[model samples]
Every structure is written in C-alpha cells, then in structure tokens.
Target: MSKQLIIDFVSEITPQLIESKDGKYKFRGIFQRADVKNGNGRIYPKKVLEKAVAKYQKLIQEGRALGMIEHPPDGKTRLDEAAIKVTSLTMNDKGEVIGEAEVLVGTPKGEILKNLIDNGVKFGISSRGSGTLIKRADGTVVVGEDYEFLAFDVVYDPSTPGAFPETIKESREDKPMELTLETLKKDYPELVEAIKKEAKEELRQEFEERVIEAIEQKVSKIREEVKEELLSDPEIAGAKVAVEGILDILKPFISEGIAGEHLEELKEEIKNLKESLKKKEDEIKHLKEELERKEIALYIEQKLSESPDGDKIREAGILKEAKSKEQVDKLIQEFEESIRKTINEDKEPKGKGVNESRQKLSLSEIHRKLGLPVIGG
Candidate 1:
C-alpha cells in the first residue's frame, strides 16, 4: 500500500486526536482499548515500554547476583607497596625469639613522592613513651621509654589494602598528597547521557515504524480485493441501464429469467464487501499518513543531531546527512519511491521452478542496482 493510503486507514480505525501548533510538527494520539486479549495488547508510549523492559532486565540481573569482577591492578614502573620491618627479635618465656613487626603506610614511594613535591622537605616528630621513676624517690627526667626498637621504613610505594594491616605503626602524625574528586566527575557526564539517549530513541523508532508499516500493508490488501469485486458486480452493471426505465431493464432480464435467490446473494455479498472495503480503506489512509509524518519527523531529528555547523555530510554522494531543508526533502522523496517500489514488487507472483526463481531474483537485483522500481506492465 502507498504510505498515504496507510495513514488514512489508521486514522479511520483508531480515532485520532491531532494538534498542530505553529512552531511544532503535528502530534497524533491513537485510541486503544484495555483488554490484554483484545487488539490493544501492547499499547503504551514507546519510551515507557523500553524503560519497562530495561527495568525488568535489571531486576533479573540483580536476582542472579553476578559476582564483582576483580581485574589485576595496573602494572607500574614505580611500585605502590607497603612493607613491614621486623624491629626486634625478643625472647619468650622459654628460649625462643619473638620478632615484632611494624608497617607504615604512606603515599608514593619515599623517593618518587619527595621528587614530585619538589618543595623543601621539613620533618617534625612527636615521641610517646612511659616516664621512668628514680632519683631520691622522686621523679627523674627521662629522654623517652626504653627505645627497644625504633624501626621505620620509608614508604617508597603504597599497596592497596583489603583488610586492616597485620602490623601497626605507633608513630607520629603525617599527611600525604591527594587528587581532588571534583575533577573526575566534571568531564564524563555529557558524553555518557548522549550515547544512552541516542541508542534508546533509535531502537524505539525503528520498531514502531515496522509495526505501522505491517498494519498498513495488510489493510491495503483487504481493500484492493473488495474494490475489484465491487467494480465487477452485475448489480452495478444492471443499475447503469435502469435509468432508461424499470420496464426497459426488466424486458431483457425477464427473458433470461434471472433467479431471485441469486440476486439476493449478490446483493448480500456486495453489502458485506462494501462495509469491509470502507473499513479497510479508512484504516489504510490513517496509517499511511501517520507513517509519512513519522518518517519526516525522524529525518528532521537526525539532521538536527548532526553537527551544529551548516555543512552537509557527504554519504556516498547520496547526501544522507541532511544539513538543510533541501537535503531533507531529497531524502524523503528517495525513501518514498523505494518503499513504493518494494510494495509493488511484493504483490507479484513468484516463479515455480528453481531456474525460473533464480532468473527472477537476478532480474530483481539488476533492477535495484539500476535504481529502478520493478513493475509488471
């Protein structure tokens, strides 16, 4: 069916609410019923349907509870490492040695970080210990608690932590250099949203166009058959001659003795055919117009999505990238012609033999390559 006819049919089938403002393209709403078993089985806003499907998929994935992936830490020339230095090997209650281990955590390797922050290095320390009791039963000044082992290793690198470190460093206060969080968030949001939205809208539009096209084609077929029957009806033939007078039409027909039952049957058939044809014709008109409107809208949208500049994108000399009104119009014309050709070809009968089928296919291909819409003369 032609796009125009399909649009007319849909408009007739489902009462449409149409609104056209000066600055905006027309919007159409198709009325649908509620019963899940009825024809309105899957009526919903296109975006809403996609979101619902995505949400369901996410729920399923969550229910499965897929494990988190742990990729190997990136390899680096300067290692990020944390180490524990054994301070002192002490004897236990028996003649055993007990070694105390202490780990110090820091940013960058001792050498690497020091060089990066090229500023002068200033070190300050605070000691913690238990004062000793002595000297004439009074308190005595002490340098610090017995410094059994003051073991400190320079943090040349830092290793990522899984749990609390086994070793503990009882030491001074220190701070390391850090990267600010704001910088990471600022750069990626625009790119992410654009990709997601474009993909979603593209898929929704494709599905919708296919469904509308199918409905239009089916309705067109029904209308064509009815129209053919109506044009060939004998009652219509007899009606043309009846203008001469009732006696004139009956004189020739009475001699042949046409059956009354046959006339009744033909009348009934014509009535049914008329009703069916009218219904289908209306539907085809509605759907075809809707399809064309949607196609134009889609093309305009895609054109707007291209570069902000006015330069037309070159696409195999076809000018698929529409930067101006002229380009958009060209695309629409090309698409309509191609679609119409396909519909006409689909109406033809297929060959029976393998060789005949192959030849037919080859001819079809040649016609396509030549940019001609194949039709039976």
Candidate 2:
C-alpha cells in the first residue's frame, strides 16, 4: 500500500513576468528542490528525487502535468481546477532537483491565487506524493525509493510561515531560522496575544451554541411528553367526548358550525376508526389462514382416496403423522410408487425348469424310470 506525503516549500519566482497574448498571467518559479531538510524535518533523498523527476518529466511530455491550488494532498477530493503545470525539472550541482512551473491565470481559482501572489499574500507550494517514509532515530524522515510524484499544489495555510521565504538565499545559513510557536511568541508577543483572544472567543461561542441546542432539544421532548399525557387524561377525554356530542347535536342546525375546537375531537374519532379498521384487517388475515389450512386438508384427503396403497397407508397412521399438505402428498406418492413397483415385479416371467427336473431324480433313478441301463455304473 502506498502512503501519502505533502512536501511544502516556498516558490522562488523571477522578477520578470512572462506576458501572454491570451489574457493569461504567466510567471516562472522553482516549485520544489530536493535533498533539503524541509519544515517537517524530512528530506527527499537523491534516489527519491530521481524517481520523481523521471515521472514528472514523463507527465510534462504527455501534457498531463496539471496541478491545482489549495487542494487536498491525498487526492481524496477531486476538483477540476488546474491552476499550475510543471514546465521543466533538472538536477543542480548539489544533487538537488530544481523545477520550474507556470501558473494559469485563466481559471477562476487561478486568477484569485495569482492576485494573492501579486499582493504578497505569502503562499507556498506543496508537492503531493504517494510513498513510504523511513524514519531515522534522529527524528528525520526520508522518502522511499518507490515514491510516485503526483502534483505540486499551492498551499495557503502553511504551518510554518518562515519555512518558505519570498527570496531564495544562496546558503542555508543566510536563510532565517525556522520559527516555532514559542519563538514566535517571544518575537511578537502582541500578535500571539491577539490570536489567543480570538481563539478563546470562538471556543466560548461554540460552547454557548451547543448549550442552547441541548436546552432546545430537552424543551421539545418535554412538550411532547406533556401533550401525550394530556391526551391520555380521563378528564380531558371526557371533556372531548362531551364537546363532540354537542357538536354532533348542533351540526344540523348551523351551516358553518364545526369550529377549530372541534378539530381535536374529530382527530380522536379518526384515530379510533383507524384502530377499528386495523383490528378488522387482522381478523380477516387470521380467517384467511384458517381457510387455506382447511383447503390443504381437503386436498390431502382426496389424494389419499385415489392412492393405490390407501389401506396400508391409513394403517401406518401416515395421514396423522403428516403435519402439512406437502408432507401428505409426498407420503401418498411414495406409497403409490411402491404398489406400482410390486405389480410390475409380479408380472415378470420365471426362468426355464431344466435344473428343477434334474434335481428331482438321480442318474440310476432316471434310467430305471426310462427302462434303460446306466452307462458309467
């Protein structure tokens, strides 16, 4: 099974914009580089980079190296938003893979992403790949050799902002140190405090909303219970019957006499009528089952009379033993077939009587009976 990994890095864009005649804003940037310890404390080894480079080159050659912005890195969710494409990839002197990509400003999402990039919104590129990771004891991970490079997506919500610099420095020492949450608080305490305040307020609002929802659910349940109790009360039931009786007596006198208050009584009467109908239906079903059973018994009796071995079958108590019409029919069929087989066996002829005659007399007895002497005596 292949695992997924997202490689987040800053794009190193050139100053000059490559203008196009088709009203698309095009810019060049190195989307990712290999052999560097990224924000996740992981490195893509040379072998892994080579595999990715080869796969990406094939994709570009087939014009299928399309990518998107802010999409899921796992490729679980699909959106038809191809905002970027890898143009070329090459390995530098330090065995690092460098790649250039073009952003298509023709798409709606691409146009928005382009506008953000132009306004210095500070986004990074994340390369999505399916592979296995080998974690070392030093807490650094390396991508496996069987890695498949999928797409480089533009990510706006990077975990560490300083990991992606707007400008690429010649040396690692020249780049700013990777920022931690603790380090960020120490550097910008006021901004950290504002974020905390906002988070607390948001949590408080969520808790309040949950409490209100729970209370509303409880209130609705209580109201339903109260309504059911009232409906079942003896006093309420008597009053409803009395009101219905009065309405029935006055219905003929008044033209539009049935008021809103009588609707409840009407509903109760309808409920009672439905209950009566349901009971009648159940009774009808039971009667139908009884009729079917009697019909099956009649069929079994008729078939038993027509059976050839009816006397033997009746003596064996097969009719009483059979619980259903199917069992009775099976027994009848078996008995009739036995009778037919016995009749067929009796009609078959016996063999010749030559052995029987020879056994009846010895050789000397046969000669005396025929008035002749025995030859071998």
Candidate 2: pairs in clash? none
Full-model lDDT for every candidate:
0.34, 0.60
Scanning candidate 2 in windows of ten residues, the lowest lDDT window is: 166-175
User: lDDT tens digits, residues 1-377, model 1?
Assistant: 00000000011111112333532111112211111111111212223222323333442344321111111122111224423222233333332222232222243333342342234332211111111111111222111111211211222112335311312332242223232334212322333345468779899889867866875686577567656755676444334344335446555665687644365565566566556656655765776666556555555655545532112122113444445567776664564455445445555555454333333444345346437554442
Top lDDT prediction, candidate number: 2
Q: What is the TM-score of each candidate against the true structure?
A: 0.20, 0.38
lDDT of 2 at 374: 58
Q: What is the C-alpha RMSD of each candidate to the true structure, in Å?
A: 31.7, 33.5
In model 1, what lDDT does residue 44 have? 22
